[model samples]
Target: MPNNKIGGHYSQAYDEELQQAVDRLVDMGGLVLQQLRDSMAAFTTADVVLAKQVKKGDRQVNSFEVDIDEHCLDILARRQPAATDLRLVLSVLKSINDVERIGDQAKRIAKTLLKDEQGSRPSAEQLAELNGMSAKVQLMLQHALLAFQQIDADKALNVLREDKAIDDDYSRIMQQSLSAMMHDSQQISVSLQISNVAKALERVGDHSRNICQHAIFLSKGRNVAHLNDDELQQIVEKKRD
Candidate 1:
């Protein structure tokens, strides 16, 4: 719905500016998601080269973010997209920061691989589990971006559910890696690297989940991300009343 080629500026109309801003953000989200996925691949395969590539790509994501940020402000200034439109555009602005941070986490993973001067890899078992965690985080990112573009609150909530699972997996992998380190001094350094990567991935999950929360809020006018199921139910009931 966004077009860069639409030579004319936004008139006193809403439709033109709104679609352009949304389009730029969707492009930005797609790029950020790819960075997260590639960074995860870097950890899973111990592909330092791929990790570097993902790291380099973060700059583009950042650039896209700045461009979109400017566009949102311009739209707000020029069109004053009101009510739901204003909320959606503002959420896009806020969520892009999370997306950029997700790229940052991926870059952190790449840095871990590079800093491990010894070039050690995680144990095969740990690698397997880390890969699984990566897969889920990827899904969360994918869903978060999809929900944003689709404006689907249900899909956004699904991304929130995936966040809990990611944290659980991260904790499980950290425990396993730590146990290995305790048993042998030689593994201490590499295990720490692996743990750090896992933590980065987990944070990526957190950011993606936060984006979903923003999407839900934008679409349905609710802040369900911080609330438990019970609190959410009460809020829903109060709204009905």
Candidate 2:
């Protein structure tokens, strides 16, 4: 249903404007990636100062989202993009929002980590699990942004595949955390904070997957949003061949 191309262009200036919108979107995505990196580091290292910095950086991320949205609207209203160009514009519009949400998740992780008192900190084992989960989600975000930059469906599908693993990690972390809480009621607050951070990481993974889906839509002209892993794999393989 969606075509991927800049068709029926009125002028070179209009085409450049559309491309600029995409460039700006990519820039915003980069800011989100940085925020995730900083927030994860703060969570693992117990750096409240770095956490505070992440919270402050959220405002810039929010601004990027607004600016990109406005740019997309301007192109749609004035330039009236069609075909592949229209698909690209629509994908960028959706992805900006997704990136913004990822930024919010980073902020949430930072806030939760900052609230944790010294003696109430999660055990090293729990922190290790959180670190591993954070690393995986950060990788996902990196690759998702790369998929958008290259418009590579294969890369996007790879991100889609990663979502399941992150989900499993979240489940395992929660289960272990709950077990720890049961053994020591005094650790309940720490366990809850760990659980919250893990949940935030899971949400970042979900947003990364959404960005990958948008990349697939932009590149393949197919709506793979609702497709399961098996279905997505089939589509991806067919495209590769």
Candidate 3:
């Protein structure tokens, strides 16, 4: 009975079921995004309490993934969705896996903070660079979730393009951390921890990009995961025209 693009099923119950699954997926995305933010804050500020909270939150994120996966499987078995509905189900299934992995990456960062015994922190300049990189990837994750909620291919494409900047930031941070280790042997432990955090953040960016690719697939009904930026742009633009 709902008047929407995804509606029109002969059974109104089927329409509601699909919408509920989407709503749950969006809720899961919000929780994962918050986990990432909390983990970054804990790492940067050395807040043990927040870091512990992030670790505890990972369990909840995992639960959501399992629940959603079951719901999607139920839909597939019962509804046998076709066309756009099939794409929606498949995209949700793929995106939730990426979302769960993002949560794991956040947990990895939290563990790095908890395991660090060295009192030394990154230099102010390096911390600033890390903060900048964190903000970029956080924005990317947020936008990717929004794109999925709306099924907006253009927004998803933009999120996909931003991954390169995160990659560059990761490379620069690795170089700086290595240089610090070389200059002061005593700083090696802390530098290694910083490198690990950077690696986790880099992986978060990758998972966020994967979610965006799933969003594009949902909207366009085509897998853009392997397409380069230029190729993806052409496809999205062609859809617009």
Q: Provide the overall lDDT of each model, using Cα atoms, as 2-decimal numbers.
A: 0.77, 0.86, 0.87
Ten consecutive residues with minimal summed lDDT in candidate 1? 1-10
Clashing pairs in 2: 3-84, 4-84, 5-84, 5-85
Scored by lDDT, the top model is 3
Order the candidate numbers by lDDT, best to worst. Answer: 3, 2, 1
Candidate 3 or 2, higher TM-score: 3
Most TM-score-accurate candidate: 3
How far residue 167's Cα lies from its native spot in candidate 3, in Å, is: 1.2
List the candidate 1 regions with Cα displacement exceeding 4 Å: 1-13, 233-241
Residues 1-241, model 3: lDDT tens digits = 2226567889989988888778888899899889988998998888999999999999999999999999999999999999999998898899899999999999998998898834777777777788899899889998998888888889999999899999999999899889988999988988888898889889989998888888888888778877898988887777533
Residue pairs of candidate 3 with colliding backbone atoms? none
lDDT of 1 at 180: 83
In angstroms, give how far residue 45 of model 2 lies from its true place. Answer: 2.4
1 or 3, greater by lDDT: 3
